[model samples]
Target: GESVGLHLPTLSVQEGDNSIINCAYSNSASDYFIWYKQESGKGPQFIIDIRSNMDKRQGQRVTVLLNKTVKHLSLQIAATQPGDSAVYFCAENMRGAGSYQLTFGKGTKLSVIP
Candidate 1:
């Protein structure tokens, strides 16, 4: 089955350091990708997104990169902070017959060590 998965299940970063999370998707047809952050007891919040037509997109303190050639995606965080500790997920949106189907990755837990 087509799915999205992360290269690592957990990532630990020291405070003020930079962190990178990698994800791989099986569906090459997916045209849209999104990165989400989920804090404890909270729902996933949108972080950044990238379209297949482009290779990269940047947000406030984060950047998302897409490599359609290998069906790979990545999220980078600058100056990691305690508040940045959360479960990060990558989602791929594929267009179906009449609607879009969203598939989420298993998620990578980001631990910020102070």
Candidate 2:
């Protein structure tokens, strides 16, 4: 079963350094995953995502890794910047024919230190 606040925390990084964010999900049946970045008072912005069929996926300056064995996922950011400081979140969605909803994990707030 998917619920809320599985483990949303915070992550801090220095400017120009690489950052790694992690998430653990409860639904093994979930096949779709997405990562989002939410700044203060702003809507969430899509970062990256991965499917159950793939173990790893990458985007511009970002990487997503999935470990179904442990039901864990991780996000890697290359050269973290001050603008990257925000609350990072992970969302999981199950595969179905009908309508489906997203189960968002606890957000990790990344504080970029200059």
Candidate 3:
């Protein structure tokens, strides 16, 4: 799905440098989360995921950290490359309320400066 916004906050990182993207969520009942990378004209692709029982999880060059107390989520990219340039979004799985619901945060566009 597309990151819904006309103007999104952007984070620019130098090539080969590490990048950190942050997100804040309101629902405390959320249990699962996933980070997706979306390139222009394409749908978002899964990068990594973390569960509420876990504080952090790693996959390939990406790491996802969750702080339930602060209801904050972060995605860390190691050794950023040109291919990593894209809009990143965090999705939360909201359990209960009769059925499962997934909420998406405003995306951050990461630009790798070569």
Q: TM-score of every model?
A: 0.91, 0.88, 0.93
The candidates, ranked best first by lDDT, are 3, 1, 2
In model 3, residue pairs whose N, Cα or C atoms come closer than 3 Å (at least 3 residues apart or on different chains), thus clashing, are none
Error of 3 at 86 (Å): 0.5
Residue 4 CA displacement from its true place in model 3, Å: 6.6
Report the C-alpha lDDT of model 1 over 32-52, residue by residue, as the tens digit: 999999887788899998889
Please write out the lDDT profile of model 2 over residues 34-78, one tens digit for every residue. Answer: 999988778789998899999999899999999999999999999
CA RMSD of all predictions: 5.0, 5.0, 2.2
lDDT of 3 by residue, 67-95 (tens): 99999999999999999999999999988
Clashing pairs in 2: 8-106
Q: Give the top-scoring candidate (lDDT).
A: 3
lDDT against true structure, model 2 = 0.88
RMSD of 3: 2.2
User: Which parts of model 2 have CA positions greater than 4 angstroms off?
Assistant: 1-8, 95-97
* Alpha-carbon local distance difference test for all models: 0.89, 0.88, 0.92
